[model samples]
Target: MKFADLSSATDYLASLTRHGVHPELDSISKVLSELGSPQDKFPAIQITGTNGKGSTCVILDLIYRRAGLRAGLFTSPHLLDVRERIRIDGTLVETDVFLEAMQSVCLAQEKTGVSLTFFETLTAVSFLVFSLSRIDLAVLEVGMGGRWDATSLCVPEVSVLTSLAKDHTEILGDTLELILQEKAAIGRSGKPFVGTIPPEVLPEWERQRSLRGFRPLLRGQDFDGKWEGETEAGERAFSFSGQALSGTYRSSLTAEYQLHNLLTALATVSVAPWPVSQETVRGALLHLFHSGRWEPVPGFSAFLDGAHNPEAAEHLVRQIQAVRQENGKVAFLSGFLREKDWRSMAHIFTEAGDHFFLTVPPGTNGVEPLTIASYLREQRPGIDCRTGSFKEICQSAFNWVAGEPDRLLVVTGSLYLVAGVQKWLSGDDSPLHAGERTSASPPS
Candidate 1:
């Protein structure tokens, strides 16, 4: 069946949410095989991590394009449009192009007689688009764990693990060591595996690298970087020293914690076969962009971030604290998926803000706002906590910060929530509801 429009195509994908996450590659493999194995047409650099993988993938894609290479990038959980998940030459694929690719994937699935999940279909579509576009390389971010993620089918020239933390524990594992093994498995036998890991997981990472027989380029050992002071134009300045390359760079992305992601991207490109000059790297950094990560709403004293888990929440809190240092009172408008360690995140957030507005994201797995509000009130007796529908909470948060110039509202917790807020901010009157449980699966 061919889709006549983008809406029809996306509806078809949304319906696949019923299949949930199978976490295996057999079905995607069959679909790709029937479609002429498009993933093999271009070399790839596959990245997997609990956080920062999307940022790293985008950074690498920008650098490749700046160096005169056509790079295709595939990331997950689009903030606004599903087309955002697939980009070629640093531009979102046109609607017509996405629909065409979806048609091909649909036909292939029918011919192969293999059912695919929402993410699996998108993966196949990305590969098909890149192959048809004749991209010089592809930078793929794993949707979840590495071993069974459809993106793992590619034999990457270099594999990257950005950072490890407790997330998707229900599927990956319940401990840090188990999580590391699942993510680190993205490394190909002879390829370079480059990334940074917490000190606690270093030993386990080493064991995984030895077992997989992939070259290890650990951060602070094989390569390292330091953050310099911010530039006058509000860009972040950093210096990188790696095994294959070294340079001082500046990024338009000003989040302090993004320094680690920048360093990871540099390390990945340094060892990859593609050649990128220092000048190109510097040029690319001057215009880098990633949405919904500490994104400031225009003409408003608010920011949106998708920090769902405790580790990411910790990074976000550090940024919030910096704002507080300037006599700013921070307030959070937050929502989280039920599967996440929301209690730990709530604990961290309490240290960042005194006022909270809680709401459920537009999906089945989102934690109820009343439940989160009750927990917060119990944890912090005098804290100002309120619960309501997502839209009501957003209006209340905006009104709370309306007249106080020093009060900053932060919309965060889940990317799904951030997307809803962004659409609301853009004056889209359509009901802000995600169609189904199609993205990441919640724990059983």
Candidate 2:
């Protein structure tokens, strides 16, 4: 297919990922080889886990770039734009550069007659951009289970796993042990691997590390971080102490649970080949901000978080309750995708928030908004719940929050919902307002 603009190219790629899973690296490896294996042109750090991987990537990128290294960061399911998935030296690659890299991958696929998944093509494009820009190092977040994930095509200097939980069970496995087995495959021989793995999954990770001849740096045993306190502005004061480095850092990021992700990133940096000063790490933490992970939208009184799964939802509830003032009304704007633990998520949010606004996420995978409304009612009878288009929900949420000074609004459940709500508020032409009809039953 011929493409004249980034939108068309991205739309075509998105179509490929619908009901997606072509879990093999042969096609991506071949396409990269055709393009001179751009992924091998630079050193990379691979990160994989069920959660906290994106936040860990963001922290590592901040530290590397702040230390004056030319850093390339590639993550998935961007919160605002696809360009956000690929960045060079702390800036999104220019539109022209993104399109040029994508075009090269398209040509390679046509020549090789190897169809690539949406994620595979984007991964190739990121490598191409990194090669063209001559980045010193790249930080890659694994798109899914790591064994055959497209982003695992590169040979990483360090492999980091943030935290494991129940997600993508159909593709990964039904149990945490099975899921950890897939994620543990990212570690290679002689490569430094680090992460916070649950006690139950430690044996599998150890087995992989032993077979691969790589030493695994455990989170609590090898390194740890503590949330020291919070400022009046809600900024967190945290400290990281490891065998190599120890320091107290301040961050504008307020989520208390992120201290675990921060420590994992710090541990990876400490063991990485690159040299970064404690001062640089401190500075980077102060300015670090990642969108849609307890991110507060500017010019609005709401916070956005992608707390899709039960584990993440538990964290979201704690964070909200911690910051909420006594007698303050907690208002929520939530939308979730299908196949998620919507019943658990509903109970969590309804317990934490006094009022709820439900909206459908931006695609066919969206769980029907009213389906969640029903779940919320079952959990909390007579709960203040309303549903409509994204804009309508936001308008209602804004009006409700405005009624009280101590009210706080949290937008959570799915990243797609946060992105859609952000676009609607930004006055962009967003797909969220379409609000297509659906009567799908909520997950059991």
Candidate 3:
């Protein structure tokens, strides 16, 4: 069926994913060319990495908006509405605008006679929407491995890679070297690049830097950040010295990993050609709140974190352990996609607690809850693992840790699972509530 409105349009786009990933960028490039190359109309800042890409992009978007610029942000795998993927001036683009852009993108695809994958269509839609809105700058986050991802077609003013890890090993290659090579390829020739790469990947990234002939803004060499201590409000306070906005920065984010992501964002914005004042940068961080990353549910004791991969899972376990009481019980309500390294991640959680309830991520690609529970059992023999409906699992987890000040309830594994719980917590139990756009603020 042809897409007739916003709902149908999103469904139609979702349908394209069944055809599998088409990594080549020729089709997206053709669609953009047919649409008059809207991507070229504005300056873009490209962000790519195995982890922390979405959080970093969101922080950069807020910072850019506070600088008095109409920033356009394009990120992937929206927690709620599909419109969340594309935002103008720190707000989601209206449904009418999103529909109009999708319509134009479909028309451009027809004219070019080139098939676009789900992400490719969204990439085109973002470019079209940004062009129509006359945005001052566009922040594009690479959907996956960046060599031929749809967002790689843009010519970025600065490329920021925030910490590479072994998340997409099946597609991007299993080795860290191979993965870094693919991600580092997002760097444009003769443009500034910044990254928080590991020492093992530094040689590969440096090689790419030499080949691309761009000035390198590295983490250890060009900039350094340290977590000083906690603020009076119980928030994390960090200190960094770099060419960008540097000082003792304070954040309310509960995860320690966010400190590195924030520094990477600061480095990117500092090197950009735009004029962003220290006051603006500070103000942006003060108001920053991206959902599904250590986000607390409105009226629940549980915290939601979308740390599906092993690298992020390690960080999450540490954060939980840091605040958890010595004898407090920590029950986990979690789900995961099929392709993720759930085994490695599941083992990491075993160290934090043995109480877990696994559920499916609400989609075709979701691994069965029973399957994940079985894996957890194998990882930690005699662990308390349960599987059932989303509601039952959530209620059970809450009950397990209820009213105990030190006892913790965590909804983790996948962002989709977190979104599912967020919907249920809002008094709307339907998983499809994410796609049902109404007159409301962006999720969380």
Candidate 4:
């Protein structure tokens, strides 16, 4: 069935929530095959890891565009529009084009008699769009673990695993070793599998690489980066020396952890067939921006970051501590999914903020704000913790931190929560409002 418009198309895709996340690859393979295997039309760089996958994808996209290549990017958990998940030449895919691709995928699914989950359908849509657009390169972010992720259907020219941590434990695995094993499966035999692995899991990563027969380009041993002082314009400056390329670059991204992502992107691009000059890489870094990741809210002394898991929370806490040292009262407006380790995150957050405003994120499985507040109170009786709806909590947090130049409010925990706060702040009343959309459900 053809969708009459973008709204109807999005609604139809959203309705696939009933199918949930089926991690196996058979369904996606069938759907793509029906579409003439568009994913094979162009070379790709596939990225997977517990964290930094999205950032690495965006960085590679920017670098490719700067180098004058038609690049297609596919990343999950869009903050606003579903169309944001698919981009060509650094711009969101046009509505007409998106609808056409969706229609094609729907027709393919009908012919195959296979039900596709939200992520699988979108992945097929991305592949079709990229092929039709004749993109020079495709940067695909695995929606979840790499082994059976829909995006893994392509034999990427380079496979990248950005910093591994314990996340999506319910699906990926509980320990770092198990998680690495799953993510490392994206690597293809004889192709470059470039990324940084924790020292503790080096042996497990080695076993995975040996079994898969992928060429390893491990960080620190084969390549590495050193953080230089910020540029005069406040951009991050770092020097990267690797086996394929060596250069000093600057980035507009603020967080310290972003340096790791930049390194991964550079390494992947350097090894892939794509020929990006050092000058183009330098130019791309200066304009990089990933919303809802340490992004400063307009007209407010606040920032929004989607630090949902314990590892990410630790990064956010480090940033908060740095801000505090610079003389600001740090406060948090946070929410999380029920499946995440909220207790560990809560304990970690205490090192950064004294005031907490809790609210439920959009969609199902959100941890109750009152429940988080009670836990926080039990842990630190003197700490101030409040609970309410997203709007109520945001307003109260704003009021509490306003008018003080040194006071900063951080809205974080889950990307779903960050999206809701961002949409409310921007005054968008669309049905995809973060409060109403169930797009945050885990996608395998």
Candidate 5:
């Protein structure tokens, strides 16, 4: 139950995959039962979406923490390491802590011989750790589909659907509406659920949520954004109503498409079971920051995002359009895994951004660099892309962009790619900027 046990714990956790194909609620329920029903301990703010769930979860955490509540957070596919998946009051649970939790889960599974998939087991550990920490609330992000997700065990007081789009077609469905249905499964009877799906899909989402027995808050219908003034920096501001609260503040993430997520977070907290004040809402927004949402990091001044899908890539472009002031070279550092919607996403980024520093980070879902570069070159005839060591490629891009301060270095493709950069630049690989909390976590 110490740090030295991590390797064995990891093997034990990995062995849970032998449970075979993922099933519905019962498979997950059995795993949680092994942990003594930790999922029932905390009131949760459940979030599910193709993208932006992570951002909204961060915003919810900030608001809850601002209101002086101990909040627990759980997200997927950590950028740097596994410990990022569990957090109490914004600080990540330590390595030793995770190893201990894993030991408990593995021992329970072994004794019971209860089969558990990777996500199910991890979700169980996160819930147990959070329950033991005595968090006032937990902001749980769904791994894939909404209804059957391991985190869906708890019936949340409020569920947030943050801006749906077409991404996972295989397991979910081929169309946006089908994917929306799968994601919208997070809703429960009488629970307040907010739809962050774009305006086009709002009608079906509305009908779906109503049939599911939840109060639905649909964007572009219930609330209206009025043309508002600009910040001194000339940022666009919109005043939107959230049944109970509204704000016309500038988003620091610099992604134009993030408005949907920001509003979704606003609506979620407005109808939350835990009471919050207007001052708490205002205070939270002023200092809000998610790890990688077109974030402008220091020194290299890189723009980081975890967009690996076609729709997400399109959203990132819209975000870039909002932030980019003038003409500048964008040095791209990217990677992708085998199952990614690469053909769809390829056109989204390859057509807009310059070229890429394609790489395959060790122990990651990142697509091989040669494969990515070749595909990118074929898709976009004029683009220049190359394969190289991830570290050198990231460094070269950063230095190349740093020389032209006006230019930008866009690092994306996968959270695994971002984690490789974070591990080297901010990890123990370098002493320059150590202990920095790089937001490398992303939804698969």
Candidate 6:
């Protein structure tokens, strides 16, 4: 099979684990062992958290690339292409190359009777591609909690946690302590577990580190970054202590909370024990780009942060505090699966000043537009918001933008929603055709 024949890697992996007896690490580890442990050759930075994992991975890729090294980045649930899951130096992999890698992974698994989950197969395929491509460093984001995620197979040079929060309660445990335990699973015997978590999580984190025998780089304790000021270019100025970088300029992604994620990225970059420089951090931060996180299209602004759960909704609201505009109606194009906290998610972002554009991506997890509109009215009465096909919503938003020219528009609430809008806006077919209602399924 060739790269062009590699369109449905997820489908192929899904077939293997369709009736998953379990999602365990040991089975995945043993299978990788049979395949020659391609992950062992992939030296990388590992990041896990309820949010900000994708942003951190992007920053790591940018920084390492700036350091004159070939960087491979593997993230989840790509917006446009499966190639987005496998990138070198911030660019998507070529079609033929990616297909070859997937073919190789399929061939490797034939000999290892133990089946790998969708995420596990994707992770393994990424490692195989990165290793064979001669990547100098790979940045791998945990697909879920660190402990059992397929990416956990390697011992990363820097293990980073970015603001622990509640998510994936069914697969992980129901509480924060249990959630942190699952997330902290990536920490190896001696690798430094660097984090930019809030001070409130310190006590529980320290206790866990002691038990795991992992070295800790707690933010504000081991290393920290200071917000210098806002630059004339409208970008932010900040400096790091652990990495010893000064006057670093950052063009942020998603939320201003991303500033904290950026700080952790720098901390990991600084303490990486490899020959990386402050200049590299600056260069990387300057060019660092990740789509679907508050990305803006021409004529209309489209913010694409996935606010599936309550905590993410709160964070998105907090990040929006920095958004300044004199006047223009605020409207949101948002929707989610029936299982999520839809009422709370919408309330946090639907303030006194904003209008709403209800949308459901064409996916299994997608909440119907009218259903969302019904919920929105139940949450807050008499607020006029459009509910319809995603393309119709974008045209509505774009038309609104043409009139106001300065109004703020946000398209969020679900990854499926983002993928659909991204595909439509870019003039390509929306990937919603691939949507599987995972959020509505019974607990694993």
User: What tens-digit string does per-residue lDDT give for candidate 6 at 7-56?
Assistant: 46545654765644355777677667766788888688898988888877
| Candidate 6 vs. true structure, TM-score | 0.89
Q: Global lDDT for candidate 2?
A: 0.82
Give candidate 1 misplaced runs (Cα > 4 Å).
363-365, 429-444
Candidate 1 yields a Cα-based lDDT of: 0.85
Q: All models: lDDT?
A: 0.85, 0.82, 0.81, 0.84, 0.73, 0.70
Model 2: what TM-score?
A: 0.94
TM-scores of all candidate predictions against the true structure? 0.94, 0.94, 0.94, 0.94, 0.88, 0.89
- The RMSD (Cα, Å) of candidate 4 is 4.6
Instruction: Give the runs in model 3 whose Cα sits over 4 Å from its true position.
Output: 1-3, 429-444
Q: On a 0 to 100 scale, what is the lDDT of residue 294 in model 3?
A: 77
lDDT (Cα, tens digit) per residue for candidate 2, span 1-444: 567887887788788776478767888899999999998899999999888888889889988988999999998778666788898987778888898888889899999999888888889999999999999999999999899998888999999988899899999999988898899999989888998888987788778877777778888899988988765464678888887768888775668778888889889999999999989888777766776777665545568888888888999899988888898889889888788887788888876896889888876478778888888887788998899987788889878776466889998988888888777776874222100111211000
Backbone clash count for every predicted candidate, in the order shown: 0, 0, 0, 0, 2, 2
In model 4, which runs have C-alpha deviations exceeding 4 angstroms?
325-327, 429-444
How large is the C-alpha RMSD of every model relative to the true structure? 5.2, 6.0, 3.0, 4.6, 3.8, 5.9
User: What TM-score, to 2 decimals, does candidate 4 have?
Assistant: 0.94
For model 1, how does the per-residue alpha-carbon lDDT over 329-441 read when each residue is reduced to its tens digit?
A: 88999998887899899889999899999988865478888888889888999889888987898899999988777889988899999888988887763322121111121
